[model samples]
Target: MNVLLVKDDCGRSRKTCHMPTHTAIIALTKGGKQLAQRLKTLVPGSEIIPNKGKIHQTFAQAWQDHDSLICIMATGIVVRSIAPLLQDKTVDPALVVCDEQGRFAVSLLSGHLGGGNALAQKVADVLGGQAVITTASDVLGHTALDLWCRDMGLAVTDKQGLTRVMAKLVNTGSVTLYSEYPLPPLPQDIIPSRTLDAADLLVTSRIRQKENIVLLHPKALVAGIGCNRNTPAKEISEALDHACRTHQLARESVRNLASIDLKSDEPGLLAFAHAQNLPLDFYSPDQLNQVEGVAASAAVLRATGAKAVAEPAAILSSGGGPLLVQKMKFPNVTVAIAEILQPFPTLF
Candidate 1:
């Protein structure tokens, strides 16, 4: 992941962020320039982002370009400027702060899933300072919800449920970590359960609705799509997005896109997969037609020489799991969702 280091002054403050792994730095003048040059020695791939007048603007620009941020300036200044860009724990980049003297490394924001807390610890390790982390779960020695989901590669279907369930974990209440999949050792605060009625945290791919239950969907869903020639990638994307949302499926859980090999070079389908950053797997018409129980479409069979493309491709790509979404047609695109098979419903 790309890291952005923003510094106002030199000294240990700038050096604290110049970890050997950092990729770039943004420095305001007044001693920041020389620090950037010196930082180049320690971090090979790191580039110095030159800044003079408005440090806030440079920092803002880095917010979009980088995966995580480390500010070697006052925490208040960093917070005020980044307040506008703070979205949520899932989408926001990790942010850390260090004083000019580098006495303390603080995780200012996105400490859990975004990895701010770990970055702070790394900074402290480098500068021989204290890593200041104040998140309740971290302080209380409980498993952080965001960290747990991230570690398990699960995507929360409903973020609202996650907030409430996290509150429970932080408040000394137990959370049932239900997984049919064998998980590693879990924290004391999380216990395994089998039923939704007894669960506060559920890890599964099946659609479920419950209040105050954190639902983590594993990245085990596979999608298959078929689109008309020259169809805009945007429309295909929107159609798949709608299908996932409407079915209460986690988009992050989608492993890849599948389609008939006949369209191996189809630009529209390839564009959609590229936009989603998922691999596109294509099978020949014979392969797609062999998958049993795919929804039949006379038109698709006539046009593509396959009885069904979307549903069968999805099931086959997912290694023949049950289909979560049957073929859904919208505009010039057809989409389907299937869960990647696992031994159990929930995994540890």
Candidate 2:
């Protein structure tokens, strides 16, 4: 993965982003050599790009070239630099903000799947500072629904169904059960679809063609996340990938993307959410909070207030297993994806 490090104000110009398959580090400053030196020590082999103008100018230039952005500056500067880069079509690099003192590191964007969350943690570890991570699943250290699907080798056939199942799991910690064949009872709903092909049925239960059976299980929740305007889709995708890798899960089982009502119209997020045939579930902040064990970040808490732990936490907590996917970043935005899992039906 190519990482970009930008520091403004270094006297000389160095283009490390051009290196073959390496992470680029751009240091933004008003012409300071110290920043460059500091970044070199922090991220070895990282390309250092210097901009002597405002942070936005540096971002404008480097924003188009990097996969992830780490800001070793104050929070205000970090926010100002990225303000202009936010957009729908662009997969924004994961954004991390760190103070010069490096006392606390915050992942302002792409905390879950986008890698910013993980990156922030890594930077904090390196700097010997506290990484203020706020993702619910990370704090809880439990398997999410998407992670479960990936682990079990199942495919998501219906995004809507998956979303519904996840929401219920987060809210009530359980889901209604249903099935079509004489399969062993599962903990959740197991509605057999006539349109489902043999391949769709990963487990064989009493081979009935069209029967309606119901099972209820508590471990079938899912997670859903959204990104800021223009956040890179790639960042979100990477986050999901990292989540899966961290949990040793698979990718084929993810079912849907969840977000607030406002983000439902975001073209970039919608494109990703729909592409996987993942259902898009939009809820109010209040509705989101029904999920248990979800950690709320300052950004998510501020935006949604008491809603839910932002969209990502709800998805992460609701999902029963590890994370199925990570966040993908676009020009300026990122998103999270996951799958829901239920018990395999057996007929004997």
Q: Count of backbone clashes for each model?
A: 6, 103
- Predictions in order: lDDT: 0.74, 0.50
Model 2, 1-348: lDDT tens per residue? 232323224221111122342234555444323544665677644566666676677888766776666666667877777887886212566677776666777877765434677677877887788988765445555333333443343344344545455554455544333333234433333334444342222332112333322112222334466567665555656665555455544444344455665665566655554444445455555555665554445565676554443344436433444334444433444334443434332223
TM-score of each model, in listed order: 0.78, 0.40
lDDT of 2: 0.50
lDDT of 1: 0.74
Residue 121 lDDT in model 2?
Answer: 81
lDDT of 1 by residue, 162-266 (tens): 888888888865678777455667777888887767888777765677666667777788888888888888888899889998998777778778887777667
Identify the runs in model 2 with alpha carbons over 4 angstroms from their true place: 1-36, 42-45, 88-90, 142-348
Poorest 10 consecutive residues of model 2 by lDDT? Answer: 10-19
Residue 313 miss distance in model 1 (angstroms): 1.6
Best by TM-score: 1
Native-structure RMSD, model 2: 21.8
The TM-score between candidate 1 and the true structure equals: 0.78
